[model samples]
Target: MLRFKELVLTMQEFFYFALRAFATLPKAKRYWRDVLDQAFICGVESIPIVLVSSISIGALMSMEVGNLLEEFGAKTMLGRSTSNAVLRELGPLLMGLMLSARYGARNGAELGAMQISEQIDALRAFGTDPIAKLVMPRLLAALIMFVPLIALSDFAGLQTGALVAQYYHKLDPGIFWNSIYPRLLPMDFVVSFLKAPVFAIIITLVSSFNGFSARGGTAGVGRSTIKGIVASSGLVLVANFYVSKLVFDIMH
Candidate 1:
């Protein structure tokens, strides 16, 4: 169809634009301000959301694990199951999804808007590395912040869940903690924590690329923003499955 051809062409152009953005970074200290903005602003602002989501995740997973194990008279193993799952997969994936939906889309839209407004072009006129200035810092910040957030989420979620399962669910806290905590080997946390950085790369890179590549006017920017979020979020889910499996396989 003619429409399909146009779609393909659009994507092809987008890649070229991304490459241009990549070329924007210069070899200097000028980019640090942008990186700091990403780290302290974008990355820091995302924390409260991450914490709240993590707590909910912990409580919910506890219920699921507790209910399932309780039926098997393995209620004490609730902590183990919950901990392993969070440390290995859920934590990074959830945080990435949240970031993509919240921050990723926002970044894309901001850049896209700038592009439409000709601000990016203005910077290019002045010989700036938009990629280094804009994209790289976001990517760096994401890589920096995401891993810690994942670990925090996993630990907090599991603990919160365990507590809920203990009193609210009439479960034995001592048994649950003892049985489950021991199973969360270093590898479990390491595997999930590792994925966060990879996701960070994916998120900032994809989003910033999408934003900078946005063409036309307001509609194009809006489209790019939505697509970036949706595509990045989907990538996170798919990536989680493959990466988690690969890590566990290697660990085991």
Candidate 2:
């Protein structure tokens, strides 16, 4: 019961925290430079990790699924199958998890450090809305950047999968792409692209909240950062499933 109450209180605080962050969206113009910096941190800096994960997953899926399909003489379906998996599901999902770790951890650790060092308090003492100056910019950056990251993830994954299909499975490039482009649907793109902002929200808010709640000095920063990454990554996975389900249900 005590734990439950603490959980409820934490939830309440987080609700207000996220509310304040979103409510400060208009203040973005005031913090445009910070927003640009955060964009670089979360977006541009995130590309390498995102591409590595997506390409690895795409190759693995193509090779493994291609082998399995070959058993049933269904190698021609490789493009369609791999395309669906990469574009609709794995692409966005991997990007979210990677960003949840990379971007989320950065937000948590940076803000947690600021919190512990009393920098945030100093801002508040000076009559500055810390959420508006700090968290809002990160939130805005993530929301704006995640979409393109997802697009890049999809593109890199599909291209890597195509290469794997050609060399590893001895499939023709033209055949593979032809099978993919024709079968591609708007829903596939919808499911892939829509996840960008959803993941952006979950990652940015969760991390920033934990950061603001940091305590216990340096150790607290570490704990808060870990908590942020774990929580955001888990939430990303959950949101991925629900978003896919919700979209497919509505569209199909």
Runs of candidate 2 exceeding 4 Å displacement = none
Could you estimate the TM-score for every candidate? 0.89, 0.99
lDDT tens digits by residue: candidate 2, 1-252: 999999999999999999999999999989999999999999899999999999999999999999999999999999999999999999999999999989999999999999999999999999999999989999999999999999999999989999999999999999999999988899999999999999999999999999999999999999999999999999999999999999999999
**How many Å off is the CA of 24 in candidate 1?**
7.4
Per-residue lDDT for 148-189 in model 1, tens only? 788777778888987888887787888778876556577776
- Candidate 2 Cα deviation (angstroms), residue 158: 0.6
Query: Model 2 Cα displacement at 251 (Å)?
Result: 0.4
The true-structure Cα RMSD of candidate 2 reads 0.6
TM-score result, candidate 1? 0.89
The true-versus-predicted C-alpha distance at residue 55 of model 2, in Å, is: 0.6
Clashes of each: 2, 0
Give the best candidate by lDDT: 2
